[model samples]
Target: MMPLPGPSHQPPPLHSTAKRGRPPAPISPDAGPSHCAWLEPVRNALFTSGLTLDDLVVRSGYSKTRISQLLRGNDYYPSWEITFSVTRALGLPTRPLRRLWAAAAREADKADDWIKNCIDRVVHDGEEPPLPYQAFTDDVRGVYTDYARAFLLTDQRARWVVSQAFDILWVCWNTATASENLHRYAWRLLRSCVIARASRHQDGRPDLRAAVFSTRGIRDPDVPGHLVFFTELIDLLDAITRLPEDQMDVAVLQHLCGAPHHVIARILGLAPALTRAVDHHARAALEAILTTPTPE
Candidate 1:
């Protein structure tokens, strides 16, 4: 049966490709509704305590602009040093702020520890590890085999496939709150596993396949430098296939054009006949997704 065209599941908009160093926005007089009452106390405390911006800057090692922005009411969300320096600068003996400071310090420590635990779980002595997201392979299998049993058209294949893909996302999302680096690694890891999961039935795309798992293991131009480079390339390819039109995104396209097909096919389970179809499908999907309107 002819597959229906898939919905464009473009990734969320990202920050500008340029490096992030946005200038502090010009503070509106109307800005910062909640902290207005404390502004005078905070400012007067700075003066009475003899804690100049220079002193706080020197102690915290934060830049002049950062200190200036925090103090002049230009910014309200205070940093660790800003808050602490104010407390110490004021010589406040109050137990309330001290408790708050302790909680903030504890939260920061917890974030660090949480990430370390995830790292330990994901990477063993030195080998690639079995990831939690691989459980979604069941979803992939069930969708292909059992989805036809449901009322929807096989054309709706893209919808179900994309939905199951969210499980991999959940695994990564849960891990991200603890350690972003680990989350990134897990995301890439899941991408690769997903290719293998879906590849069970497809015909194949030889050149793309060779690139995904070449025994020779040449460093391809399209692959990213992170830990899961090889498998991610294949998963990017598989994502193209599972879509209604069978295409990859620009992010995924970069990976696809990099390597040979047999490698991609083996890793992603692409069939012998479907390679060219996948390539075309990926390109078209990108176009449609790029132009589609999104919900608020």
Candidate 2:
């Protein structure tokens, strides 16, 4: 307290972390919800390409802090410019990641609308506005390809699962207030429904081999002479259905639905490390089961 600092010697402002060439620190993973599913793939691509966060910052012309936020899913929704830049920097295929980014952005915008509507209804004591069916349907349609692929692999149950998911959503809209993120909630509900249906079908199976082979129309006309391959595929699906619930769910999400581990973790309310371990165990079990010959 003996001497006061001069203007030139004053400490830097708290918000002035940005520098001409220096990048900021990355945010911790636990900082926020990991809703952006495409981020993990971008991180993996960076690792595979031997690139660093600084490299991404430089290439994308975004500050290190913003890049970190987007990559870590700390941002509620990433912008298209950020997505394009990061995708370009990582040399990843753009279309799928773009679709995920777009879906997330739409959800974020809709979340704001939902929150406002909720507040208005509460303050005015008016009848809650009906949920926007068109917007909801559009959001579902965005990810339907992946969702259908995941459930269809088992027994062509995609149509049924989609219908059931929408029905559940309608019920939820009538009963519950708006959620923090409606799209994520709806997607998780859909996945849970699919998993429950798959488990119900697999329960109490004594001889999986007999049951799998006895099922009709397991063959694909597109593959002219790969009967053995088709049979092996069916056996693999049966093995997947036999896995413990956590492992089975992780496997279906990762492989069939093409979800990243972080996305699976968020959807299942699990830690990322736990999700990765479950997927690893599931893969190992599948390998063991698939390699073993079926009883004659």
- lDDT tens readout by residue for model 2, 1-296: 11222355332221112223322344345432223244544554454455577777766677878877776666445555565666655544444444444444554564656434333332212123244844665555535535554555433466655654554454344222245666556666666555444334534532224333323344345555467656766677678777886787677566556677876776666778988888888999999888888799
| Index of the highest-lDDT prediction | 2
The global Cα lDDT (0 to 1) of model 2 is 0.54
lDDT of 1 by residue, 104-125 (tens): 3343343645434433332112
Error of 1 at 215 (Å): 86
lDDT of each: 0.39, 0.54
Query: Residue-pair clashes per candidate, as listed?
Result: 31, 0
lDDT, residue 126, model 1: 21
Q: Tally clashing residue pairs in candidate 2.
A: 0
